[model samples]
Target chain A: MIEILKQGWHTTIQDLGRLGSQSFGVPISGAMDLNAFQWANKLLNNNSSAACLEMTSKGPELKFHEPSFIAFTGAIMQAFLNSKPVKMYKPIEVKKGDVLKFSSVTLGCRTYMAILGGFQSEKVLGCRSQYKGVTLEDRIVKENLLLFNRNAFTQKGARVKTKTTDYKDVNLKVYQGPEYHLLNSHSQNEFKTKQFTISPSNNRMGYRLNEKILQQLPEIWTAPTLPGTVQLTPDGTLIILMRDAQVTGGYSRILQLSDNALNLLAQKSTKDVIKFELITL
Target chain B: MNNKLPFTFFRMHPKVILLEWEQDPSTETLKELTHFKANILKYSMGVSQITLGYCSLLVQWKEDIINYSDAKKNLIALYSNLSINSTPAKTKHWTLPVCYEGEFALDLAHLSSELKLSKDTIIELHSKTIYTVYFIGFLPGFLYLDGLDSKLFFPRKKNPRLVIPKGAVAIGGKQTGIYPNESPGGWHIIGNTPISLFNTKNETPCFAKSGDTLSFYAVDEAEYQKIQCVNNPKAYLTKVK
Candidate 1:
C-alpha cells in the first residue's frame, strides 16, 4: 500500500483506458502520453495495460508501506527518493517507509509511475481509468491510500536510458477532418501557416488553441468524435480533443492529429507553440 | 427503405473507419443506421469499439491485427447486402417522472411566455409525445432525445450557464434531454428528475440506450421525493410496449 502525503495538481490512476464504452458516452480517460506510459511499464516488465499513476504538471509525494519495485517515465518531474535524486526511465527498488517526492516539472506536462505488478483499483466498466462519473473519485486526493500486491516478484533493477525529445516547440502532423472542405481556400491556407499556442484553459478534455480562424460554415449535425480530433467553434477557436474528450460533438472537425502527433502533443504545456502539418496516408 | 446506400466511407484514423450517411435525421434513416450498425457488429472481425452518431458510425479496430484495406472492403460488401426491412433487436422503454416547480424549472415560466402558451399547456404538450433515444454523447448517460413537440422548440441560450444541475430536463433547438450530471450547458431547463439516469455500480451504467423509447410524466415535488428514495431499478422501470 502507498499513501499519498500531498496530492499533485491532477493525479489519477489510469490504464490503457476504457474501450468499447464510447457508444454509452464514456470518455477514454487514460495517460496523455502513450509512449511514456508504455515505457514506464516496459521498464518494470509490467503488463502494457497495467494501471499506473498519471501526474500532471507535478507529482504527489507518496510513502510506500512495503518494499516495491517502481519505474518513472514521461516528463522529467524532478523526482527524488528519500531526499536523494532519482533518474527517469529506469526501475528503482524502494524499501518500506520510503517517501518519494516530485518537485517542479522541468520538462513535459505529464508523468507516469508504474509499479512491479500494478495498482489495484476498482474497475468500473472494464477499466480502472479514473473519470468522475465512472470512478468513485476523479483524481487523487491527500491521504488517499493506493493498494498494490506486496509480494510481487521484482526483476533485477537495471539502469537503462532512452532518448527524450524536447516538447517546447512541436509540429503536429494531422489528417484532414471530415469538414475540412468546408473552410474556404484562404482559411485553409491560414490554418496551415499560422502558429497556434496552447491556451491556458487546457485539460484532459481538450487543448484550446490561442489563435482563432473566423471562418463561417453551416451548422453540422452532431457527429462521432475521438481523441486527436480538432474542432472549430463558431467563435473560431480551434480545440483539439484529448484522451478524455467526448465521444461526439457538434462543431466542425477540421483536423485530426496523427497517433505520433497525439503522443507528442500530450507532453506540451500551456503557451507551447505548435504548427499543424497536413499529411496524406 | 431507400434501395441505394447513401454513405461515404473514409478512414478517420489508421485503424478507425467512418461511414457517414448523407441523409438527414429521420425515422427512415435512423432505422437504416440501426440495421447497418447491427450487421457490422455481427460480421466484422477484430473490431474493438463501434460508436453510433446522429448520421454516422465509427468502427475502430486493432491496427496490428486488422489490415485497413481488408476491413474497408469487408465493410463495404456488408453494407451493400444490408437489409433495412429486417426486424431490429428489442428496445427498452422507460417512463421517467419529472418535477417542474420552484428551483428545478428555471426557464419554464420564461419559455411559457415566449412561446405564447400557458405553463400547463407547455407541460402537457411535452409529456404527451414519446421520445426516441438517438445516441448517448457529450456526457455519460446524457441521452439526446428526439421527438420534441414543435411548439416547444426553443433556441439554445446565447450565453451558456456555467453549471446546469443534474437531472435537469432541458430543451434546446428542436431537442429535449435530461442532464445526467451537473456541467456547463446552453439548454433551457424546464424540469428536474430525482431518479439517477447513470450509476457506475450497475453492469451497464446508462439506464437507456440508443433506439430505446422514453416518456416523461409530470410529478409533484412530493412524488419526486418519494421515488427518489426507491433504490430498486425494477421498481422504477416499467415496460409500456
Candidate 2:
C-alpha cells in the first residue's frame, strides 16, 4: 500500500479507457499522454493498459508502505525521494517508508506515475479512471491508502533512467474538418500562421485554446463531433475535445487533431505556445 | 422540387469516409441507414466500425481486405440502388416515473419563473409531451432528447453545478435530457426520475436507445420512495415490439 501525504491540484487513476460505449454516451477515459503511460508500463514490463496515476500542474507527495519499483513519465518536473534528487523518466526502487514528492514543472502540463504491478481499484465500465467531480463520487486525496500486488512488483527491478532525453515539442498535426471550408481564407491563413496558448480552461472533457480560429466560420447548423475534434465556438475560441467529450456537438469544427497529435495535446501545460501543422495526406 | 437525393462521398482520412446526407437521420432514415450499414458490414469484412449520428455516418475501415477506392465504389453502388421497401423494425416505448417535489427538483421554481409558467404547469407540460431519443452523448447513458415544447425553451444555468445527482430530469436551451449518473451539468432541473437511465450491470447499459419513444409520468413523493427503495427498482415500464 502507498499513502498520499499531499494531494496536488488533481490526480486520477486511468487505464486505456472504456471502449464501444461512445454511442451510449460514454467517453473513453484513458491516459492523456499515451507515450508516457506506455513507457512507464514498459519499464515495469506490465500490460500496456495497466492503470497509472495522472497528475496535473502540481503533483502529489506519497509514502510507500512496502518497497516497490515505480516509474514517473511526462513533464520535466522536479522529483525527489526522502529529500534527495531523483530522475523523471526511468524507474526507481524505493524502500518501505520512503517519501516521494513532486514539485511544479518547468515544461509540459500533466505527468504520469506507474507502479510495477499497476494500481488496484474497482473498475467501472471496464476502466479504473477517476474522473474528478464527474463520474465517481470520490477523488484521491491526502492520507488515502491504495493497495496493490507486492509480489508482482518485486520480480524484476526496473532499469529505466530518471532523465528523459527525448521530449518532443508540441507540434500538432491537424486535418480539415467538415466545416473547414466555411472559414474565410484570411481567418484560415491566420489559424495556420499564428501560435495559440494553452488556456486554464482545460480538463478531460475539452481544452479551450486562446486563439481566434472560430472567428472565420460562417453560420451553419450544429454538427456531430468527436474527441480530437477542434471546434470553434461562436466566440472565436478553439475548444479541443479530450477523453470525456460529447459524442456530438453544435459548434463548427475548424480543424481536427490526428490520432497521434491528440496524445501530445494531453501533456500540454497552461500557457504553452503551440502551432498547428496541416496534415497533407 | 424533385425529391431525388444524390449520394456524395468525401474523404475524411485514409481510414474513414463521410457519407453526406441531404436530410437528417429521422426515424425512417435512421432505420434505412442502420440497415444499409448492417448490409455493408455483412458483405464488406474490412470495415472496423461505423458511427451513426444525426446527419452523417463515419465509416472506419480495416486496411487488410479492401482499399479506399473499392470501398467507396461499393458504398456508392449500395446507396444508388438502396431498397426503399420498409423492413420489420424493433420499436420500444417507455413510461418513466418522475418526482417533482423538494430537493429532487432544485431548479423547478427558477425554471417556472423564466418560462412564465407555474411549477405545476411546467411539470404538466413537460411530463405530458412524448419525446424521441435523438443521440446519446455528454455522459454515459445521457440522452439528447428531442420534442420539448418550444414555449419552454430556456438557456442552461450560467454556472453549472459541480455535481448533479443521477436521474435528474432537466432541460437546457431547446433540448431536454436526463443525467444518468452523478455529473456536473448546467441544465435547469425540473424534476427527478426514479428510473435508472444507465446501469453498467444491466445487459444494455442505456435503458433507452436511438429511435426509442419516451413518456414521463408525474408521481408524488411517496411513490418516488416506493419506486426508488426497492431492489431491482422498476421505475419505467417498457412496451417491447
Candidate 3:
C-alpha cells in the first residue's frame, strides 16, 4: 500500500483507457505521454496496460507501506527517494516507509510513475482509468491509499535502461484531416508556417493553440472525433484534442497528429511552441 | 429504396477509419447508420471501439492486430450487400419525471417571454413530444435528443453557465437533452430530473442509448422529493415498447 502525503497538481490513475466505450460518449482517459507510460511499465517488467499515476506539472509525495520496485518516466521531474535524488527511466527498489517525492517539473508537462504489477482500483466500464462521471473519483487526493499486489514484489526484477527525449520546440507531424481542404490556400500556407504556443486552457481533453488560423470554415453537423484530432473552432482557434477528448465534435477537423507526435505534444507545457508538419501516409 | 448509398471512406487514424454518408440527419439516415454499425460489430475483426455521429461512423481497431486494407474491403463489401428493406431495431421508451420550479428552471421565465407562450403551455408542449436519442455526445451519457417541439425551439444562451447541474433538462438550438453530469453549457435549463441518467455502477452506465425514445412528464416538488428518496431512482424507470 502507498499513501499520498500531498496530492500534486492533476494526478490520476490511468491505464490505456476504457476501450469500446466511445459509442456511449465516454472519453478515453489514458496517459497523455504513451511512450513514457509504456517505458515506466517496461522498466519494471509490468504489463503494458498497468495502471500508473500520471502527474501533471507537479507530482505527489508518497510513502510506501510495503517494500516495492518502482520506476519514473516521461518529463524529467526531479524525483527523490528519502531525500536522495533518483534517476528516471530505470527501476529502483524502495524499502518500507520510504518516501518518494518530486520537485517542480524542469522540462516536460507530465510524468508517470509505475510500480511492480500495478495499482489496484475499482474497474468502471472494464477499465481503471479515472474519468469524471465514469469513475467515483476523478483524481488522486491527499491521504488516498493505493493498493498493490504483494506477489508482484516477491519476484526479483532487473533495472532496465531507456532513452528519453527533449520535448522543447518539437515538430509534430500531422495528417490532413477530413476537412483539411476547407481552408483557402493562404490559410493553408499560414497553418504550415505558424508556430503556435500551447494555451493555458490545455488539459487532458485538448490543447487550445494560442494563435488563430484566420480561416472561415462553416460548421457541419456534429462529426466523430478522436484523440489527436485537430479541430478549428468557429472563432478560428485550433484545438488539439487529447486523451480525454469527447467522442464527437461540431468543429472542422483540419489535422491529425501522428501517434509519435501525439506523445511528444503531450509532454509540452503551457507556452511551449510547436510547429505542425504535414506528412503523407 | 436506392441500392447504391453514397459514402466517403477514409482513415482518421492509422487504426481508425471513418465512413461518412453524404446525407443529412433523418430517420432513414439513422436507420442506415444503425444497420451499418450492427454489421461492423458482427463481422469486423479486432474492433476496439465504434462511434456514430449524425452522418458518419468511426471504427477503431487495435493497431497491427488486423490488416487495415482487408478490414476496409470487408466493410465496403458488407455495406454493398446490405438490404435496406429489413426493419430497424426496436427502440425502447422511457418516461422520466422532471421538476420545473424554482432553481431547477432558471431560464423558464425568460424562455416563456421570448417564445410568446405561457410557462404552463411551454411545459405542456415539451412534455407532450416523444424525443429520439440521436447520439450520445458532448458529455458522457448526455443524450442528444431530437424531435423537440418547433414552438419551444430557442437559441442557446449568449453566455454559457460555468456549471450546469447534473440532471438539468435543457434546450439548445432545436434540441432537448438531460445533463448526465455537471458540465459547462449554453443551453437554457427548463427543468431538473431526480433520476440519475448515467450511473457507472450499473451494467450499462448510460440509461438511454442511441435509438432509444424518451419523454418527460412534469412533477411537483413533493413527487420529486419522493422519487429522490427512493433506494434506487433507476428502479422507478419504466421501460416501454
Point out where model 1 deviates above 4 Å: A158-163, B1-3, B64-67, B84-86, B231-241
Question: What iRMS does model 1 reach?
Answer: 0.9
Model 1 RMSD, rounded to 1 decimal: 1.9
lDDT (tens digit, per residue) of candidate 2 on B11-89: 6655667776767545665655555665666666667666666666667665532366777788877665455433424
lDDT of 1 at B46: 72
- Please state the CAPRI-style docking class of candidate 3: high
Q: What is the lDDT of residue B72 in candidate 2?
A: 79
10 residues in a row with least lDDT, candidate 3 chain B: B231-240
Candidates, ranked, lDDT: 3, 1, 2
Estimated TM-score for each candidate: 0.96, 0.87, 0.96
DockQ of 3: 0.81
Model 3: per-residue lDDT, tens digit, B1-241?
A: 4436788887777788888988778767776787778777877777877899998998888774346678778888878766743445666788889999888999999999999999999999999998888789888888888899999989999999999999899989888989988999999999999888778877887877777778889999888889877726456446755
lDDT of 2 by residue, A1-281 (tens): 99988887888888887665666766767877777788888888888888888888878889999987888888777889999988877778888999989889767777888887898876776778775423453357665686677887444655654344234565788888878888888888977888899898888889998766546455443345667888887778889998777766778877888767887888775787778888854
Q: What's the DockQ for every one of the candidates?
A: 0.80, 0.49, 0.81
Candidate 3: list runs displaced more than 4 Å.
Answer: A154-157, B1-3, B64-69, B84-87, B231-241
Residue A243 local lDDT, model 1: 93
